[model samples]
Structures are given as structure tokens and as C-alpha cells.
Target: MDYDSVRTVDTAVADALIGERERQEETLAMIASENHVSEAVLEAQGSVLTNKYAEGYPGERYYAGCAYADEIEQLAIDRATELWGAEHVNVQPHSGTQANQAVYHAMLDPGDKILSLELTHGGHLSHGHPANFTGQMYTVEQYEVDPETGRIDYDGLAELAESFGPDIIVSGYSAYPRAVDWERIQAAADAVDAYHLADIAHITGLVAAGVHPSPVGIADFVTGSTHKTIRAGRGGIVMCDAEYADEIDQAVFPGGQGGPLMHNVAGKAVGFKEALTPEFEAYAQAVVDNAETLGETLVDHGLSLVSGGTDTHLVLVDLRDSHPDLSGGDAEDALTEAGIILNGNTVPGETRSPFDPSGIRAGTAGLTTRGFDGAAMEEVGDLIYRVVDNHDDEAVIEEVGERVLELCADHPLYAE
Candidate 1:
């Protein structure tokens, strides 16, 4: 990953780029929203397509000189269609947030009612957090998980829908660990004569690989980030039935953004092609297996896992019971110093601020991409528990750092 040309032009930027590559190579990436893209995807994202700007969809661009752009964009749309089995696909949203924004713009009015999960309870900002545009524009009514079980309370959601009478219901989450029952959410939306937008931003790859149930056929609209679990370059996608295809396309292009990132479209094409293979299916399953192992290991060490365990690639650990004095921020800092990376997240019933929450969320997607297995994840879990348990101990941190380095050596991220 040497940036020879970049070094010749600007040494400082090149050095930072190389430094980032080295950082990824040496450390663990357990952030549930992150993943390691394949070299092919990297190359595609860095290709000459970045020089072009296609203002519209394929064969109907508002600008000339978009032949290759059309080709890449169409390939991405086709591959996404095949993977999700959606009748229509739009691969032009710059990120998942934008993908979601497009859905709102296409189907919602400024003050329309939106019923979604609460942010602290596993919802995303785009779902309707006040800080985001979605919250400011829409009248949002939030639902919560069953505090005791740490899972979505579908019965409560139906009741909430009846009372709120929302125009649309948003499902999918950022930190939740269990598989969602799309049918249940869809039924709620149906009873209220509302639309359903399922944002699978965190589980795009799992859905693509069939490791998780897909919402393409059930939800009125489905959106996701291409990079998180999909290993595609950074981008977003929207899918729906053919009836709403034109409205979605117009909303994404003219309403939300202009000039799609063609290079990222190419990357999505390549990554989606890679995901279609049998090996990718096995990899997705392994990711879930690793998370299960990590969660069980943490439980064995007497830590509290929200929802008891995970059915996906992440486990949310509430630290209040196990390490009352240590904040999630403290654990994050200690783990990063020890070469193991993850995020401090808010649990379902968070008692602290989001900045220094009471929970840590660890994921297995990046590790599985780098060839990590259940046993490796178990060891990683132990390392995390040690660091979180002894966050202030420099000696413990150094020892854990050494073991993490050894683990990184065993599983190299990108081949030379």
C-alpha cells in the first residue's frame, strides 16, 4: 500500500496514509460498524472513475462522457438486485445516512409522523435522533427494547403504532445484537396504513450472504451502508419494489445529492460480486460464530452481556454490573493502547452519558475477514475482559498489548 506518487507530491499526507494502513495491520478492528475491504475493493475505490461525474442513473445521465460511469453504476445496481432480490436498486447515496434520507424525501412530508426505535435503545441518528435532520423534520415517536430481555418488544411497537398513527415506521438498529423480525414490524406498519423502511446499515453483508433474514421483500423500503458488513468501499444503497423506483431514483439524485461517486460505485460492483460467491456465505456464518464465542467467553468471565448472547456479529456488554468503576471510555482507551480496537456504546437502559457510556460493543466482521475464528475470538474476548477489568494497570495493559501483537502476527490483515 505504498503511496509512491503521493510521497513524491506531498510527503506528509503520504506518511499519514501509510501510518493508517500500518495501524489497521497491527490492531484489532472490533467496531461493529467497521470492516476490512478486499484489495480489489480498495483498488476500485482508488480508480480513475473518481475523475468522472455522472449526474443521473445509467443511460440517462444529465452529462456526457459517462459511458464507463454508466457501466460501473449499472453493474452495481444489477449485483445489488441479485444479492438482495429487490426489484429496484439505487447505489448512489454517498452513505447510509443519505440512503435513509432519500427514503424519507421520497415518501415523507416535513412534519409526517415517524415511529422508530430509540437511539439509546439501539436506534440510529438517521432513525430520528434530535441531533439529526430526520428528527427535526419528522415528528418521531420512539419504541424501546424489553429492558429485562434486552430485545425488541414487538407487542409494544404495535401498540405504539396504533397510538402514534405514524406515516412511516423505521426498523433496524446500530447496537442491537439479535436478529430482527421484519414481519412483525411490517405487520405493525400494515395495520396503521404506514410505510416501513428497514435500514440494514450494520448487517448489509450478513443479509447479502443470507446469514441474516433479508427485509427486501417485506419492508416498503430497505437501505444500508455498503462498507460495514459488506466490505464494499464507503457508500449507501436503497432498494424497493419497481413501483417506487423512479421516485427513489429522483430523490437520491436530485433531491439528496448530485454527481454520484462513480469510483465507489465501481467498488460496490466488485464487492457485491465477491459477496455472491459461496466463500462469502461461509465468512458471514463464521462472523456470527465468532461473536457467539466472544459473548460466551465474556459471560464465563462474569461479564454482563445484553440479551444474554448475540445472533449476529456483535455483542453489547453492559459494564455497570461487572466493572462499576470503569467507564466505557476508560475501557476503550485501555483496549486501544493494548492494540485491540472497539467502541464504547450505550446499552439499552444507559445510566451514563453517550460520551462515556456504560457499555462496550465488539464485533467479529473485520476479524473474520482477516481469518479469525471462534477460538481466536474467545482469546480476544479474554484480552478485552482483562483490559476492562484492569484499565488503570499499566503492567496489565502492556501484557495484553503484547498478546494482541502476537494475535495480529498470526492473522495478517492485507497481504503484501
Candidate 2:
């Protein structure tokens, strides 16, 4: 973790790099969309591939001296294909949002209708929030969860699909905590003669490890991040049937982005190879188990959980019932000060602004990757509840922060 080479060139940047590593070592990363990548992935991403310009897919590059680039990118595509069982895989979208953009670009025309989950109800901005390009470029309609259950109202979504007649239906989520019935969503798409884009950005590892149901063979297209649930460094992936292969490939390359981040592709290749090991399967299951333990512990402390629990790596907690006066923003700031890093998220039936929402979201991917089991996760949950319950008290925050440092020392990250 020493940035000696960087130090020789510029001490300022080197210090920031070293300090960032030390920060991760001390704090817990419980944010649902984040996880720790392996040292192998780190090295791969920091490799010399960054200097190359591979403007196209493997075997068809626009630049010379791309033989190695072709090899690495091909490896990444192949590994992703094997991982998700897709007829086609593109490993060069740079981000999950771009991967999604490629799909929209390939099949959709301007002003086409898109039906997706409402953002505050566990959806993403890429799913057509007014602030994003998708909203401006297309006609969008949103569905929501069953207010009483805190889960997706599949029947309601299907009904909406029928009425909206969307060109493409978007499934998957950012803050939702339940297992998605991919077939149900696909059926809705089929009934409307629409394409279905299942964005499994948050649950990529869970789906690949068989801990969560996959949308690959069922849905028309699947997109995700190489990080998050997976140990990949930082990149995006798109999977589709053979019929749409060329269209997707074109959309991802010149249509969306100019050049692929070869170092990131190398990272994806290495991380995907690591994910194929038996150890990763155990790790993925542990992520879900740890989330369940955390949720149970929170419930025991009188917290209300969305969907009452989780079937994935993250859980969404509605703080309204337990601490009506406490804003999620205040709770998040206090938790960060206490070395527990998670986000204040909007709940399904949110009654407050998105910025200072009514809930907090936490995940177990980072902790489980650091070797946290059910018992440890429960204790972490206890610590979280303590902080939320006593957010105004600096003494309690300080005590919990000390315990957090002790726990981090016990479960060190990037120790290699």
C-alpha cells in the first residue's frame, strides 16, 4: 500500500493515496452499493494497460499495438459470458449506467415510452428520473411498491405496463431489499411486446453465485457493475441474446463511449476469474446470511425493516417508526463519525425530502468479504442501532467509534 513511486514524483497525491487506504482500514463500508476489491484486481487496474488506447472490442481495434489489449478484453468478455450464461457479453461500458445507456441507444428511439420502478421506491436515476438524460430523451412512467408491504407490487407494475405500453420495461433496483421475480417482470414485458432490461447492478455477485435468481436467460437484456456485489475493481457489463449482439457491441463502443478503460477491463477479467473459485460462492452466500443477521439484530432493537428483511446483500431500514424526529442525514453523519459508513436512503412510502430521507441502507458485502460471520454482523447491527438511538450524544458516539476501531483491527482490509 506504500505509494513510494508516486512519492518520488508528487508527495501530495501520494499522501492522499496512502491516506485513503488507511481510511478504508479504519472504517466499515456498509453502503449497499460498495465493496472491497481484491489486491489482485487492484494491481490489474493499476497496470500499464492504462497507457493503451483500445477504441474497439477485441480483434477489431482501431489502434496499433493492441494485440495484448485484444487478448485482455476478449478474456473479460468470455469470462463474463461464462459467468452469466449470456449469448453476448460486452465488458467495456465503463459503468453500469453506461451499460444501460447502450441498451437504450441500441433499441430505443427518442420519445419512446419506458416503464420502470419509481426512484424513491427502490429505483435508480438511470431508470428515468427527471434529472437524468433518460427522462429527457424518453417518455417515462413509474410504478411503486405495495405501501403496506414495502415490496414491489408486481401486479401493479404489470397493470401499469399494460396501460403505459412502454418500448422497454426496466426491472431491478438500487435500494430495494427483496428477491425479484424476473419471470414476472419478463412476462409483463412479453405481454406488452416490449424489451426488458434487468439492471442487476447491486446483485451481480449474488446472481452469478446462485444466491439470487439471475435474469440472463429470462430477460432480453441484463446490465450490471463489475464491482458492488462482485470483487471486480470498477467497470460495467452488458449481456444479451445473440440476435442483439452486434447492435449492443456497436452501441457500447462508438455509440456511447470512445475508448475502453483497458486497465479496468483487466481488473474485470481478473476479478471474474477469482469469482469462479469455490471460495467466492461461499463468500456470496455469507453476504446474504450476514445481511439477514444484521436485519434480525436491528428488528430486535425495535427498528422497522423494509420487506421485514432481505434476500440480498443489503437491507433498508425505515427510521420513522423508531426515531421519528431523527433525520437519516443526521444519522448518516453520526454513523460516519463512528466509523460505520452507510447512506441515508429514501424509503418506499417516504414522507420527507430525498436529501434528508426517512431511512438508512446498509449492506454486508464489505464486512462479509472481511470475514464477518453472523455473530459479528449481529454485533455490528447492535452498534448501528446504538448510534441511531443516541445520535445526539457525543459520548456514546465516541464509545461506539472506539469499538469500531477495535473491530476493524480484528478484521483488517487489504492486509495483503
User: For each candidate, what is the lDDT?
Assistant: 0.94, 0.94
TM-score of each model, in listed order? 0.99, 0.99
Candidate 2 global CA lDDT score: 0.94
State the local distance difference test value for candidate 1.
Answer: 0.94
Model 2: ten consecutive residues of lowest lDDT = 75-84
Q: Which segments of model 2 are wrong by more than 4 Å?
A: none
TM-score of 1: 0.99
Error of 2 at 220 (Å): 0.3
User: Could you give candidate 1's per-residue lDDT for residues 1-416 as a string of tens digits?
Assistant: 89999999999999999999999989999999999999999999999998998898899989999988988888898899999999999999999999999999999999999999999898999999999999999999999999999999999999999999999999999999999999999999999999999999999999999989999999999999999898887899999999999999999989999999999999999999999899999999999999999999999999999999999989999999989888888899999999999999999889999999999999999999999988888899899989888899999999999998889999998887
Tens-digit lDDT string for candidate 2 (217-294) = 999999999999988969899999999999999999899999999999999999999998899999999999999999
Q: List candidate 1 segments past 4 Å from native.
A: none
Cα lDDT, model 2, residue 297: 97
